[model samples]
Target: MGKHIKTIARPALQSTIKGCGCGECQTSCQSACKTSITVSNQVCLKESKQHR
Candidate 1:
């Protein structure tokens, strides 16, 4: 008998964002990635530090 393996979806940044857009999602510096999964420290820090 063959065993079946269930497939799991990759955790995307959108899922980690908690809320969609709504301003709240953008608050976290870690969630700054356009795609959101890969957190861009340079951009997030630069944006928040320089812009804010």
Candidate 2:
């Protein structure tokens, strides 16, 4: 019989900042910005499957 594997999504160690033009919060900081900035540190997940 063949075993069935389950897939799962999980955050990886490597991540990047989103909406930050300079990659670093210099003049326009999302947290301190008056206007709504969808700036956030995004973590990418790998497509992996697990065996149960």
Candidate 3:
């Protein structure tokens, strides 16, 4: 007969969600660019998670 195996618990994972710093920009165009960049990055991360 085979010996029984035990499972071990893993530590909780931590992550930081950072923005593209659109709010810190002086011009409206710059702010809009930041916002778009941030949103695109976020969406990419989400998709990557699903694939993994």
**Of the candidates shown, which would achieve the greatest lDDT relative to the real structure?**
1
lDDT of 1 by residue, 1-52 (tens): 2268555655555653653334422443444455454434324443355577
**What is the overall TM-score of model 1 with all chains considered together?**
0.19
lDDT, model 3, position 41: 33
Q: List the global CA lDDT of all models.
A: 0.45, 0.38, 0.42
Rank order (by lDDT, best first) = 1, 3, 2
Clashes of 3: 0
Alpha carbon lDDT at 39, candidate 2: 41
lDDT of 3 by residue, 1-52 (tens): 2368554645432332454343433332335545543433333444355599
Candidate 2 TM-score to native: 0.17
TM per prediction: 0.19, 0.17, 0.19
RMSD in Å for model 1: 11.4
RMSD of each: 11.4, 12.0, 12.6
Worst 10 residues of 2 by lDDT: 43-52
lDDT digits (tens) for residues 1-52 of candidate 2: 2268555756643553443234333233466446534443432122121221
Candidates 2 and 3 compared by TM-score, better number? 3
